[model samples]
Target: MNYLETENNTKITHFVLVGVSGQPHLQIILFMLGLVMYLITVIGNTLIIVVIILDSRLHTPMYFFLSNLSLLDICGSTTTAPQSLINCLQDYPIISYNACYAEMGISLCLGVTECFLLSVMAYDRFVAISSPLRYMVIMNKAVCLGLTGISWTIAFLTSVIPMLVTPVNFCGHNVVNHFACEMQAVLKLVCSDTSTSLVLLFVGSIFTLVIPFSFIIISYLRIVVAVLNIRSTEGRLKAFSTCGSHLTVVTIYYGTLIYMYVKPQTRESEDKDKIISIFYGSVTPMLNPLIYTLRNKDVKGALRKIAGKSKA
Candidate 1:
């Protein structure tokens, strides 16, 4: 492994990222692939955000939350893609200590926020199905704002606090074995005692992953029960159609995330981790807009209307 000369204090100044591949040719291939996906992610999500804002027909509780998710996808992709793609071009790509920390912090915050937000979305679907008349009343502007605000606060508390509270010594290892400064990957380089940091992170993962995921499952189960109570097949189909996209996205996103964490990390599994990271970090974000838009009649109608207006 290539390394930089250490300072007298052995204070780590920067980190050399091994990136996806050590081979220059392979790195270039990955870089091109990541660039195309990143562009698609940005454009697709941006279109969703724009449609949600412009189409008065879509100005509802569901679309409101969806717009926020689109924004998050854009931001999440941005958090990791630029640096990773750039690093792919160089053999020894280095990130400043502060920048690496910032990357990890932003990724963690966004990840936690998405977890809670998805649960809230599942609840929204449940309310919409279980109590159609009261859905608007229950999920009013004030209520939606409150829910999203709580999620953001939870994210900040869970992500930011742990980073600040549990300071770890890196000793002399400044080599990150991944394309991005992922939390788990960086934590592996800690040369000091990691009991506090590991525990804190583990607890935060529970709040962000296990708890939210459980809530989503319960919400969907209730939604299923409510849909089953519908007398007409069309009614049930309509209800299912409304939330099918969300369920698909949940399966793709959470499925990858759960798989990423369930196994113990071994030397052999580190590459697997890298592969999973790229999938969730970039592929999921790229697919979100597609998943939400392709099956959504409301979104498609809105897009068509926007297109007509532009042509006129």
Candidate 2:
């Protein structure tokens, strides 16, 4: 159905996106609710980015990585949330092929970049825990910049190749099922043979999921071992606490992602796919800043200082 709708120069120029729930009674409430969530997600991630940028004290490798993660959360939320809010409110959520392609491209890039960056952060924690004495030397400014740059570069390159292989052909039904032009949703609309698309998605998953998951596991294993070696209970507690919040967030993000893409692609039940997509996309980004701030004293202290300074 989507393929025929996407055939070359198909009749539809703008695609409709039917959001998760369709009850008229629920739409208004969901719209308002999504708006609030979207706002909170933006504000929370933005504050983290601002705090890291303005405080020279946070200019170290740790905060640099944190800033990148916050930025990713902001970009990630923005890619999905506003459109979702609009879809919940409006009679129709329409998107053009060009716009859909752009959204899918950027979302894929940012999403993949975040997965790698989180893995890099785990390694940072591992080094800090396993070899605290040399943490500063190991994760110097040069190394920090290199890791961040490479993460973004890899993400862009991976997403771009798939898009290049499959140009936007609009010869089908224009309405995208979900709010955003996610890779799967977009691919489902393609008129061309999507084997290349599937292959590219497979390679992307290897980078975004497999490699990163392995790194995260290895880093945490080393960290757990190092923490266990600490004779003092206080020392062990502190060491584990540092990465606990991150581990929670990563588990949530990756768990849903694995469920979505790690298996063979089957036709989705609308409600089921919508709920799952919300987990990885909308809800996760909304939770990131809270998770980091609650777990890290430094961020809490920074927020307190910012609040105090504002009053003065």
Candidate 3:
């Protein structure tokens, strides 16, 4: 039975997910990998949030932002991971039009928020290093909340506003060359003129990715200058250590994104980029907790404190 209500041009009621590939072996491997990534992301991010909340010693602005980052990672991975996993197991798994757009909007919102959050974190670090005594006063509760709230608001506006202004006109049974409604895959299926949407996307990318990335770079440069002025070698090491995790994360995240975004995506590129997309979208989230906690004495101390209390 044909479910689609067609006009002269067949209206796209749904989309088909092309998992990593049509081959059964590849599909199985992709499903296993995606599922593992989703589980790891959920578990790692949740643990970070739990530790941050329970440990009073971690009640600083840096940890506070870290908690929010964990939350965003959890939500961002969830926005598409489950559906992608299901599509890997099912042949040509279909998603309704509304559901696909909803996924895109939610994920895009989270991505934009993360960009702003990372920039905010870089600023936080700069302030801490550059003005240690006044750090708390500068990054007070009100300021933290205000910055976080603004990031979410900007994210929401950026993700939804342009979409409302210029909606994509998709053709029938759009076989999205992806396991989820990735922006590129969805864009490929648009039946109408997309010059306007492309232009809007370019403008949006400038603000969402390029601008924030520039801010982070500038913030870190100042941080580097501040750290170099420290009289004590130990103080310099401590300052660099404080920033090491964030810098590592920033490099991996931005490197993958810049490479992915700049390349001209083709049919083959869509399939080829699945792992790259998954690496940024899921693997990074999973790695964040490990990155932030593994070598950090503060997080280790907090975990030990919690463990000791639980034992008692």
Best by lDDT: 1
lDDT of 1 by residue, 1-312 (tens): 112234355567788888755598889889899999999999999999999999999999999999899899899999889989988988778998878888888888887888889999999999999999999999999999999999999999988777866767777887888998987788788767777766666666666888888889999999999999999999899889877878877877887777665434332327768888888799888888888888788899999999999999
lDDT of 1: 0.84
lDDT of each: 0.84, 0.78, 0.83
lDDT for residue 309 in candidate 3, whole number 0-100:
94
- What lDDT tens digits, residue by residue, belong to model 2 across residues 233-307? 988998888788889888988888877777666434355666788778877888888888878878888888888
Looking at candidate 2, what is the lDDT of residue 108? 77
- Tens-digit lDDT track of model 3 for 98-159: 89888988888898899899999999999999999999999999999999999999998998
> Candidate 1, residue 65: CA error in Å?
0.4
